[model samples]
Target: MLLYTESKEARRDVVRKEHDIIMLIGDSLHDFAAEFKNKESTEYQRGLVAKEAAHFGNDWIVMPNASYGSWSKSELKMWNEKAEK
Candidate 1:
């Protein structure tokens, strides 16, 4: 397994280049199309990344860390509950 870290801004650059699998970690995918919701970029780079990943015939997994990555709010709630107990 390999891990690659990239910012949302940077992903716009090479998303359509070429790759076997494009696993977008965190809650970014939830808003993948949000960026171009009102924009004129019909390419839908985010979707393209996902599509390309699938077309490449490789397995892609978007595993976000519950404790730190995208579930910080829920994790905090759980922590507070534990403390209250």
Candidate 2:
């Protein structure tokens, strides 16, 4: 089997082998996947969160930062869309 460090998405993939990732703690959902990082619609990301809702407090710990990060970017996108309406 190929080591994650040898994979194409090395930065993200390498961490999988480096740690025992039982829980994810981050300021952005994007920390979990490329789809989340790629700026998909908020509804889509929320749906994924809903699907994994049971894991929030346990397997996932999201600390949204207002100062900066994907949370801020997504919020800005939402604000811009609302303004355009």
For every candidate in turn, the CA RMSD to the true structure comes to 10.9, 6.8
For candidate 2, write residues 1-85 as lDDT tens digits. 3454542345556657776668767777765555565566778888888887787889778887778765555554444767788
Q: Encode model 1's per-residue lDDT on 8-76: one tens digit a residue.
A: 445544655565335434333433433433433334544665564652323334545555532343223
Evaluate residue 36 in candidate 2 and report its C-alpha lDDT on the 0 to 100 scale: 63
Candidate 1 residue runs with Cα over 4 Å from true position? 1-6, 15-60, 74-85
Predicted structure with the largest lDDT when compared to the true one: 2
Error of 2 at 43 (Å): 1.3
Q: Which clashing pairs does model 2 show? A: none
Which residue pairs overlap in candidate 1's backbone? none
